[model samples]
Target: MVFYIIGAIILVGVIAYVAVNHIPKKLHWILSIILLATAGYLLFLINNSIMEPLRFNTEKQIRYTEVIKKLKVIRDAQVAHKTVTGDYTKSGEDLIKFIDTAEFAITQTRNVLVKQKRGLITVDIEKRVVDTIGHEPVRAMFAGKDYKNMLKIASNNNIKFIFSVDEIQKFGNLTEPVFEVKVDKKIVLTGLTDYLIRQELEAATGDEVRGEFISVGSLNEVSENGNWPPYYDKADKNLNKK
Candidate 1:
């Protein structure tokens, strides 16, 4: 693109000089060739400038969809792990093992009225109790999902998501289970244009991924949400696959 720009400037100066001076008939063909070549270069540049972004955006959605699909799986797996153990795991292998072997305790909760007396004042109080009714395999919850490769990234087969688990303080110093699984945007968008990747890395818009990493969960908060926009959630959330 830069080469075309430089050649275009030189061609414009030559055309300007030719317009102001007398030219011989022998030079007509040379001028015509230069003009046509310059026009072609300019057209190529214009078309490329227009198409690069379109191609980048197209590939972006495709690769992002693929990676986000796996990310959603990891997120759901982590949620199930937390549900069974009351905490998240940092090890991807442990997460997968838990998904394959864990059991979900089916429980039922109900409210009952109890009589309480406080200093000769008897009143009815509501009490809530929970009971373990049954048990179900955790694997049953992830039916129709991708097995084994749940931790693998779709765009790049060799690359896996960076997984971590920790606790975050909630209201009034209460800590809750938190886990984060992420991969760099550059890795996900590999072999693409560099400048566009830089622009994506600096993305701060709410509709975009909003950071350098396409991640799920947060170490700073207790959210199971991915950093992607709701457009992905519409598909991944409704797909019925963990």
Candidate 2:
């Protein structure tokens, strides 16, 4: 809008200047036509320059929103995998299979009376005297029905998101395991226009960064946090308003 306004002001100023100079009556029509054409072209450039970034910003927000959702699903699956297997899987294929077929042990504990050496004592024990009472399918933990689709990014169907698990040392003695799920932004914004893609990458990293992936959790540290910026929350809040 500001671009349009500025272009209009410049256009009007040029026409006013041409009219005030009044070189010749015959030349007025030619000058006015040329000025109008120039103004139209300038407006086109201005509108494209301003609107392209806005369009790219919006597209990026949407893509990231979906990417974030998928990343969360991966996180949940990883957590569930860790819970049942005592370790995270590095393969995306294995993760998806686990989500589709694996079941987690469900156990319950309660206080019960026990015979002690001196007297009767109350003790907390598993409901069935076993660690697991029953099992729940991993799919039950997530709302989405299709585990395969969840493994891929929403934008570019050709590319599958990456997942990896590694061990990191803590306290210089103990080693802890961590997993990271990632999807490249280039693949996420693949179908977008060239200009929009360029704008999105520039805005995201402030440079011509390649192979930038949005991810959750960390392979280098014992953390299950995401790498997205806080502005994602703001963008989601604004979207919810609409």
| Candidate achieving the largest lDDT | 1
After the best TM-score superposition of candidate 1, give how far the Cα of residue 92 lies from its true spot, in angstroms.
1.4
Cα RMSD to the true fold for all candidates: 3.5, 6.4
Tell me the spans in candidate 2 whose CA falls farther than 4 Å from its real position.
Answer: 1-25, 110-130, 191-211, 230-242
Cα lDDT tens digits, model 1, 105-160, are 99999999999999989999999999999999998988888857887765588666
lDDT, each prediction? 0.85, 0.74
Task: Quote the positional error of residue 226 for candidate 1 in Å.
Answer: 1.1
- At residue 91, candidate 1 shows an lDDT of 85
Candidate No. with top TM-score: 1
Residue 153 in candidate 2 has what lDDT? Answer: 64
- lDDT of predicted model 2: 0.74
- Model 1 spans > 4 angstroms off: 15-23, 110-128, 171-173, 237-242
Reference-based TM-score of each model: 0.85, 0.71
What's the lDDT for residue 216 in model 1?
92
